[model samples]
Target: MKKKKIAICHYRVGGTDGVSLEIEKRKQILEKHGCEVKLIAGSRSKGADYAIDELEWDQGVVPIIKENGFVYFNRKDLEDDELKRKMNKISDRILNKLDEIQRIEKFDAVLIHNIFSFGSHLAAAKPFAKWVEKHKLPCIATHHDFYWERNEFDIVRNEYVRNYMKKFMPPKSKYIEHITINSLARRELKKRFNIDSYILPDIFNFNQKPWKKDSFNKDPLKELKIKSTDIIVLQATRVLPRKGVELAMDFTKTLQKKIDELKSKKLYNGKKINADPNVILLIAGYTEDMDHDYLLKIKAKAFDDKIHIKFISNVIKANRAYRQRIKIYSLWDIYVHADIVTFPSIWEGWGNQFIEAIFAKKPIVVFEYPVFKEDIKREGYNIISLGDELETLENGLHKAPQENIQKAVQKSIRWLIDKNLNKKLEENFAIGKKYHGYKILEDFLVKKLGL
Candidate 1:
């Protein structure tokens, strides 16, 4: 029997972002199930089978289209008529490239990630919708995010651009099936467009070899200049405003004070708490272009509070590899050295880092974002909660209540000192494996694609 050929499409692939990680997992699972998978992307740092330049948002004329369509309609740079002309030209190029690839590869199905739902690359959406329509191909539009959910895309400068997004950004078609990462998004998709979608939660391969102190990843602590006695609290998500990294800093500061008070007391693991035991918050994810200033603000707060925070995105990548003779560590490698993981995102389509912490078998301090409340919390995994409500600061950062932060800090200290810490971690790993392991994804794909 001939295997089914499937193409997984995205704006960018082979990055440390959640979407890229999810795509990689799906690709691996699909291949394991006897499907020949092809990765199609606009740009990729590595591992894309087909890199179509026109499909990327920042390349060639796509940025101009983005600016004129969503940012501002500066008539002096390009009139409305000319803007449409350029949009069509770029769309045509993308369509032509996709058509050429389809003719050669003859993909049985296309799994698109974020092109139709996200508003960033407006031109690519129409071409993909058209390509699927033309070929009558079975397309699964996996929406990681929607335009209306993002503040940047809430307003459109061009009327034509708005209408185009309404029609083609997730076009209505019989060949296309929509999937959301959470129940909240599925409900929103239905409420907004009357389009029902399947909920495919973010999953992990919990059965993979456990991340341990291998020779390549043996000294992440030394590389990051962290002491063996210090508690390493990792914030593994990208440095975005919504990630609520400031809350992690706040929790760290409070936890540090408690550590100071408990000097000479034995920790749960039988290590004596030093008078000045460091609680370093290591941020392992790269900062996006829009969130550079947000990172600066986080740094400023850390400085004011005298909290030790290390920004090590330069040393962490999606996978372990050498860059410029320096050994770059994978996110999992960093996880191996972490004592606790902080996931305080105010909003998320789904929590990837939360699942990652579970797989890593580290205790997590979570903020209970809406999706978590709706789709995840019922699973009964034990985690230190930062509560659901947030208080907005004058600097525009968010904070958990003082009591909640203190409560979480106390729980973390208890967990850190507990001799049975491994037991709790084992429970989390078991629950994650039971619900969100690769088997779950395999079952879904086998049913959805009839593989």
Candidate 2:
């Protein structure tokens, strides 16, 4: 029985992104079940067997002629020339890559991530969708964000985009297996296109060892100029508007006050139950999208509340190895070192931190987003759900040995480290290794794609 050839497509796959993370986990799962995996993406992913053209948006040329590679837009102001050029770059890149692949690496199936949802690079993605349709190749679109739902789409409403998003989607999208990360996305996909998609929520590599830096973990506080006594609560994400970084500071203030109270309760010369670890809320994310006013606003909030937030972006780089001489570190590195993760996102197509926290098995506080209610809340895992207004925030920070809260946090972190939590990490391992891991190249080969 010959195996199937699968191509997972997306942009900027290497770093910590929801689409890439899910694709990596899923690829690992499928490989174990026997699938030969190929990658057709805008960026390079570590575990991929083959690399395709860089996504159109990732190319420097597109952004240089317009916003000079900035993130997100300020309004619905559409720049027709800039957008058309962007679309052209994306189309050419994908068409060239597809042509090359057709000449050589014949694919059995294609798995797309966020391409249809973010149509900036639609010229490329839409054509690929059409190719998949024409060839009758088994394919899946693991949607993280859809066009209608994204705020960015307000800036992209030209003919080049409107055609693919409104027209191409219904006609071509229905041909592939549609999957989305959150219920809201799924419902919208169905409501708009009548496409029945599998709700494959995001997952982490629970089977792998926790990502605590070997020697670097010894004194992250010292290296980051943080005091030893500082309680390191981290907001592990890219510096973007939706992450709600302001809430993390507010939460930190509450925790800091609580710490002072705990210290006061201790008797003279007595052993304290828990020492007040001089609370310090360090926001560890890339400050790419922060404008002067936004940064000023956050600083003002902290100033008003007297919260000290050490910006870790200077040290956090885009890639590992700090290879770029930029003292750069990834958000994942911060996750492994932090005492707690503060993920207060206003909106996310899918929450990457939830899975990263789960995989790292760290105690996390996730702010309520539609994805939280739509995708992960029902997953029977234990996370400090920040549903609305810091519901579990105070409790998860201080309350230990309690039944509901303590037990749940313990279960999630424990599940990451202890393979024996359920019927054995073996079942989880086999499932992951089968459907998304070792046999990824094989599973889709015969069963999913008939390669």
Candidate 3:
């Protein structure tokens, strides 16, 4: 049998973002199923086979295109006509580069990630759709997020850009199939664009060797200057407004108030809680490009509350590797050190870190976001949920209700001290394996490709 060559395309690949991580996972599964997979991206990163600079969100003409099209229109700098021209120009460049890659690779199908649905790189849509049409390529458009879901892309600038978004953002064609990461997104796409899509939730490799303390990962705590006795609450999402990291700080602060009470109890690992233990929130995700202000706001709140929080994205990479002779840990490596994982995201297409915590067999404290409620909660995983409601504080940060926070804090302590902690974790891991393991994704791809 001839191997199916698949090209997985994204604006950025081989990075820590959910889409990039998903691409890697899908690539691995596809290759495992005897498909030759090639990674094509807008920016250069580890594991990218080809890069088209114009497709990048933050580089080349993309930012300018986004400013004129999605952001406030700058008529003085780039008029609507000029902006459209520039968009078309970049689109052609991308098309040409993609065509060149196709000529060499002769891919059987193209699996595109987020380029059509996200408003971040509008220029790539038309060219990508054109190339697929020209090649008669079977395309799987996987939408991680949509423009309407984001406030930043609310203003469409003009009718031309609006038309482009409508027509080519996800161009309707017989050769194309659409996929959404959750049921909500699937319904939303059908409701908005009348486009039907398959639901492919985030998945993990549950059968792989467990992430544990090794020589490479053993020093993350010491390197971060964190005490071994401190209770590490891991927040493993990128720094963004919707991530609701401030809620994690609030939870940690409330949990810190019970340090003395914890000191009297034995930890799940059969060790006593420290006499003066600190509940540290170790954030191990990079700050997104436009969310520096949000990061600052979170830092300010942490300072005011005196929450012991550390941002260690500098030491975390997409995979374990050495940079400049210094060992950088993967997200999984950090998960090995986590006593509890906090996934307090207000919004997510699908929860990657949540599944990761379950895979790592660590207790999770999660905000019951919409996707979790609609797609994941029904699976009956054991989790410390922050309830599905939120209250906005004066500073514009969202928080779970006071009672819910206290309840979650109490449950977290019990999980930390209870000798039966592995029972709950194992149950959660089993549920995750049943619903979201790699085999689930492999079967989906096998059917999608007709292989």
Candidate 4:
């Protein structure tokens, strides 16, 4: 096939958010398969064929989101004129940039990510969806999760904007090859609007060589006050109720008791258990809900229950930049140090944590969110499963060593474990590359857009 110029649009790609990481991986794979790419968003991109500044609405502050360590860029607070103006300015710039792209290059297609599926649609995403509705330009909306899944948005009008945010999209979206991250999302898309989408779970660059954690990652940990010897049990998901962060605490607590039991018996053959655990659960990242006072209260209560949890959102703000001003580090830094990852999300669009755990070659304990069953679970992911109650946990953990995961723990510890989701990782590797990778996208272009 001849080369094609593809421009991707969405929110910022600088951080370790699921969207950012997926787009980055997609770009690398697409480039390998021969496609010129560029970026457009409120955030600048070092990875682009041409970078355009659409608007900085997402870059501004929403008093509510700010208190919760989040920014509502495209979601203007509306009460503030300056913020509103900034948002308008960014939206206008995005349209203008689209016009410019059309004028300059072949601009074969614009792979829109998450823009039409959430309030974060700032740049070319919203209007792009509208434009694609008219088939103005060949495009696709690769949704990790949809806006309707969020509980807060019940009564919304702006049909264009609302449809853009939720899985309940208009018939026009169907013309654009709807792409989802998990099977649950695909089924929901079908059930709600009869729209079928391709599944593109979050992916990592498994083909490329990885670098060792160096001074940049080291500095963030130093400031985080995390000890090198401490086993890092990370809840590497967004701070939301569905994420089930307390489960991470509960598991750590369980492990603590086992550790203590092991110590008391002085047996290392998985025979004796320890009474006290030296494990640490790091609750990292910002919660979008500023009014999460209830969440705060609950978190405090969890702490009181002896779950050694650490909040490192501010420390790892956006990236591992040492501007000497902020103590930001990439989420990858934590993944690099994880002894185990806890992702007990009630729901996930595609699941970035699953991708991270596999690529980093670590163990993970996750809930069987319906998406797991629908999307990648069957491919092979032998993870420690957690039912609603704590009863199933012991059985899950007791077989940790024999439990076959995609990769083994590099640490010296060994025990019987479950090997349920190991193959899911490889499936993830191939599917992610196909669904989001350049090759699959090329097929989508021909089949759906007829480009």
Candidate 5:
């Protein structure tokens, strides 16, 4: 039998972001199952044969979306005619480009990531939806997060915006298969839009050997001016408000106090430990998509709290490479060097960093976000909890309790010093491999695609 040709489409691919990482995994699984896979996106990549400039979620689409008025509070604010005109221009452009791709590759199936759910790039939605429907394309729309779930999209008042969001943002048709990363998203889609979707949790490559301090990465902390004695708690997410990075800062401050108390009592190799290790919160992800303002606010909070946060996004890239002056490190390198991983997100479509921490066999401090509480907690993997509740400030930044922060700090100390805890960490690896492993995704895709 001939293999099916699958095209994976997204705003961008081959990046460190969760959606890009998930797309890479999906492509691997499908290829392993005898499917010929192709990459398509807005970004330029050596792997993508069909890259379109306008398909990106960028300034080009911003005007159209603003005209559509989905983020406005009143219908009167929407210039539907202008919105339609702008969207039509981009739609026609995309449709023509897609036609060229169709002629060249003739993909048997299309896998779209986040286009429907993000609700950005309103311009691409109309023509892309029309093309897919008219061609009766076999598409699986994998929704990571919905616009409705975000506060920014709450002001959708214009009927045109609402209708366009409902219809084309991800057109619901019998030919299209919908999938959500978590069960909560599936429930919400069904409740709100009468749309049913398959629940496919995000996966990790558990079969691979655990991340170790390789020669290439062994001196990363030293290179970054992070002392060997420093207890590095890494916040390996992008700088964004919803990420609740302020919580990590609060945790670091509390953890610093706890470490100060522990320094007097902590013993190493049956002797008193003398070295003073600073508690450093290292941020490894970049601030893109209008997060510069959020980054400034986090810096101010970190300064006020006297917390040390090293922004190392410039040295980190989607993939490891030698740049002009310094060498870029993969996200995995940072994980390999981390003494502790902090995932204090107030919201997530799915927690990519959480699973990555698990894969690395590192002790983690987790904020029990809604998806984590509802879909993930039942498995009962041991992690230092930041509790389920958050205090939102007037500025909308979230803070974890000082008590929860202290608890996680103590747990991390134990994880770092106690040789006995190795057994527990090993058990965590076993559980992670069982549930979130690549084999699970491979098997799921095989069954779903009947490959």
Candidate 6:
């Protein structure tokens, strides 16, 4: 079969976000299997084929989206006439760029990522639908998340907004294939739009070399102002409300107490545990997408509890880069220093961080969110499980039981000291690779595209 020339389109790519990460991996696998993958996104980055300023989620469409009253919860009263005009104006500009690229590239299929699923940019989605409809473009719509699944988008109550969503979100086409990141999302898409979608779980490169604490990243703990004896518990998810990051703080507190109590005990490896081990919760992701008050509240909570939590996302990126001669570590650098990965998310598309933790060969503490219980937990990897139910306080803070946290600490210690640590890590790696690795993705794409 001839190599398919494919264009991957999304609002943003080349970031540490789940969708962007998945695109990078997909592009690698597609290129490896004799497909030419052109990346088309709003933001300019290294691997992009086209990066138009106007296509950005925050910038070019800002005024247009604000006029449509889509980005905020307390939106201004709708002016339908003006909103339509602005939408079309932006839509035409975006379409012009896309058409120019299509003419030159002659892509066999355009894989639209998240633009149709996320409701933040209906102007782009509507124009995309119209263009594809008119030109009869073969396309695949891969969704990391849906707008309806997010509570933030519920504020779009205007009739005009509703009409736009109903008409253009995930444009219907005979030549388009729909893909969802999880089974629950696939089911919901079918229920809401009567649209069937293939369940494509997020993928990782399990065959790649393991990330180690190299000379470049050996002293991040020192940089974080953490003692050598401190135990690093990493919350690798973004600081979002649904991420249940407060639960991670709570778990840290509980684990710290247990560690103190058992400080005198010697491990099987003949190492004495520190009585005052500073349990540092290193959060390593950007918080720009979250509400400002949410970050403030989390910081305030950590301070009140006297928890050693560091928001080190500023120093972390998708890949290692240098800023002013100072080292900007990759997410893998943080993972190398992590003693245990805490994934206390109440919801996830397919839990990219969870898969990442597995790839890092670290013990994980995961909250049994709905999708995990329905799709992931059954696969049976060894993890400290926080059950589905959460107790919410009056202040909207969430918590798991102290017992679960203690159990996690005990399990983490055991894993750390076990003589057969490599054996256990190898077993987990095998399971992760079988379920969520690049080889699986390669086969799926090869079959799907008849490559």
Give the top-scoring candidate (TM-score).
Answer: 3
Sort by TM-score, top down from the best: 3, 1, 5, 6, 2, 4
What are the RMSDs of all candidates, in order? 2.2, 7.6, 1.6, 7.8, 2.6, 2.6
TM per candidate comes to 0.94, 0.72, 0.96, 0.70, 0.93, 0.92
Candidate 1 lDDT tens digits, 117-182: 987688889899999999989998999988888776777877787788889977889999999988
Q: How close is candidate 5 to the true structure, as a TM-score?
A: 0.93
Per lDDT, what order, best first? Answer: 3, 1, 6, 5, 2, 4
The candidate maximizing lDDT is 3
Q: What are the per-residue Cα lDDT tens digits for candidate 6 across 1-451?
A: 7778988888878878788898888788788878899999886555577996666766654544744556555555546677777777888988888888888988887778888888666678876777677667787788887887877676664677778787778767887789998888988889888999998898899989998878899988898788866777899888877889998998888777767654655433333557677678998976754256778889999989999899988888888889998789999899987877899998888889999989998878889998899888887788877667788877677877777766776776677566666566677788999998888778877777777
The CA lDDT of each predicted structure is 0.87, 0.59, 0.88, 0.57, 0.79, 0.80
- State model 5's lDDT: 0.79
The true-structure Cα RMSD of candidate 5 reads 2.6
Candidate 1 to truth, TM: 0.94
Looking at model 1, residue 442 earns an lDDT score of 86
Summarize candidate 2's per-residue lDDT along 325-392 as a digit string, tens digits. 43456666777556666777877887767556555545566666777676556645545554443333
C-alpha RMSD between model 2 and the true structure: 7.6
CA error at residue 304 for candidate 3, angstroms: 1.5
Candidate 4, run of 10 with poorest lDDT: 397-406
Question: lDDT of candidate 2?
Answer: 0.59
lDDT of 3 by residue, 234-268 (tens): 99999988999988998999999988778757777
Off by over 4 Å in 1: 59-64, 71-79, 261-275
- Give the alpha carbon lDDT tens digit for every residue of 1-451 in model 5: 8998888888788778888889999998898778999888886443575788888776665544653566443334436686666667787998888878877887777888887778666666666667677677778888997877876677764676678777876678876799998988998899888898998888999888767767777777888887766777899998888888888888888778877655644432232434586888999988875678889889989888899889999888877778896788999988976777889898998889999988887777889999999988887788888898877788767777677877777776676677566566677888878888998878877766668
Candidate 2 stretches greater than 4 Å from native: 30-35, 43-54, 58-93, 152-161, 170-175, 211-213, 264-276, 288-300, 303-305, 313-333, 359-361, 379-451
